[model samples]
Target: MTDSLDPVVAKFVDALNSGDRQAFYALLTDDATMSDDGNDRDLRQWTESEVFGSDGRMDVESVSDGGRSLVANYTNSRWGSMRTAWRFTVSGDRISRFETGQA
Candidate 1:
């Protein structure tokens, strides 16, 4: 599944799975934005606590939108696992924004 992802999104997932904070952050645009459930979030802060700080990982169930969207079983130390939906907006090779929520 990872093989079919967009280059940037695949890198993001790989970074998540490997707990590579530098790689994870390198995939984003400096002004990247994110949402959780529908509300805007502070991207860096959220990524710190909810992702890198908590061991986040995803098991992708499906992909869509030319690999920019996915449905996955996502897990982290804080939230456990859930069927989650994610969408990414890319600007060139970097992810400019992303959104995720319970699916």
Candidate 2:
């Protein structure tokens, strides 16, 4: 919550806002699966979608599941901005799956 970096998901929200590509990539598993809406996409592909623009920013509202999930207000060029929820499934230190939709 509050975009604090105590949990992996918080770190992710921080990385996304900071546009730290390496930091963002570091949070994902090698074979990570990320999907937006209902279409499956890889991390890099997903970032290219808009919510990850170099200047894209986010305001995390809450985090749950011990940092494995989060809901935040996202700003982007394409979608403008909206409240969104993201859920991540992590195995050890890597995120194996990440999915997002309307919050």
Highest lDDT: give the candidate number.
Answer: 1
**Candidate 1: clashing pairs of residues:** none
lDDT tens digits, residues 1-103, model 2? Answer: 5534336666777778888889888988888888888778766867856655536787878877776677888888777788988888877776778898779
* Per-model TM-score on C-alpha atoms: 0.96, 0.84
Worst ten in a row by lDDT for model 2: 1-10
Error of 2 at 44 (Å): 1.0
CA lDDT of every candidate: 0.92, 0.76
Residue 25 displacement in candidate 1 (angstroms): 0.8
Model 1 local distance difference test score: 0.92
Worst lDDT window (10 residues) for model 1?
A: 1-10
Could you tell me how far off, in angstroms, the CA of residue 38 lies in candidate 1 after the best superposition? 0.6
Deviating ranges (above 4 Å) for candidate 1: none
Candidate 2 whole-model C-alpha lDDT, 0 to 1: 0.76
lDDT by residue for model 1 (36-71), tens: 999999999998998888989999999999999999
